[model samples]
Target: MDQVNIEHTPPAVVEYLALRQIAGLSPMSREGAEIGLPNSLFAVCLREEDMLVGMGRVIGDGGCFFQVVDIAVHPDEQGKGYGKLIMSEIMKYLKENVPARALVSLLADVPADRLYAPFGFEYTSPKSEGMWWRQGE
Candidate 1:
């Protein structure tokens, strides 16, 4: 594995879609990406020589509530610490920017919960559960 460069730049919609599909994440429509990405409070992208191999973003109302989302890395590039790289940058942003007592959350996908534990993310079940409502559903 070559050296990967992580940048505080959001991925373009095309690269975002490609990374999500390759990472086995659900797809997001182009219009959705266009509207949502620009609203990110902070975003990081990992590049290996010019390829967008990994990305993550923090989105929310930008003060009291924030969510860590869109964490993805190319399948071929997994296990190379790219996810950690992305998370580290995102965490740094959160720690520096978000106020104390602010609520930060993320929907950890099964096994990926382990990835977030070190960053102070814990299960919010039993007392409260994570839920979402799809647009047409």
Candidate 2:
């Protein structure tokens, strides 16, 4: 945790996919990452001695809608406050760049949901529920 450096850039596609798998997030295709990572509104990569140990990203239209996504940390690196570190950089970007009317959102996988709360993210349920449709279901 001492020497982990924060880079305000997305991880390489290979590191992105590998970290997602190790962190237990749903798999994303390499093609998708190649297209998506460069389109990030903002991204943070936490590296210890140049090895990516954690990352997060914001993706959306420049003004209207933005989503906080791909929050992942290598299993060996979790619980050392790296997730919070990633989110902190993300929140800084949002505060500086996003308009007040722009909506920022994320789907939190439980327990991890706790990590997002202090950053001011909240549930949009009952009033509005989260639903999804997969490409090849």
Candidate 3:
């Protein structure tokens, strides 16, 4: 982990999309990335020697609601606690910035969802199911 740096900065557009693809997350269009990345409420970028290895972001209406999104760690870099590191940074930002009663949420994918539990995320199912829809569907 030499030269590992946790930057409170959004990754560049190309690296951002590449990391998502390499991490097996859904592919995002370039135009979408251009529009969305700048709107992040908070973002963390993990770099080793200045190369992007992992990242996470928070996005939502400023005060009332928030969601964690785009949590991706490169496959070659998995199992190194980078996910936890990213989440810790995000939690710190939320604690300091969001309103006390703001609704925070994330749509976790399993096994990886376990990573979020230690950070106090819990299942919202039964009470309400998570759902999604893409454009042109």
Residue 122 lDDT in model 2? 85
TM-score of candidate 3 relative to the true fold: 0.96
RMSD of each: 1.2, 1.1, 1.1
Q: Candidate 2 has which clashing residue pairs, if any? A: none
Off by over 4 Å in 3: none
For model 3, how many clashes? 0
| lDDT of each residue in 37-101, candidate 3, tens digit only | 99999999999987899999999998999999999999988888899999999999999999988
- Give residue 6's lDDT in candidate 2 (0 to 100): 92
Clashing residue pairs found in predicted model 1: none
Name the regions of candidate 1 deviating beyond 4 angstroms: none
The TM-scores of all predictions, comma-separated, are 0.96, 0.96, 0.96
> For model 2, where is the 10-residue window of minimal lDDT?
128-137
Off by over 4 Å in 2: none
As for TM-score, the candidate ahead, 1 or 2, is 2
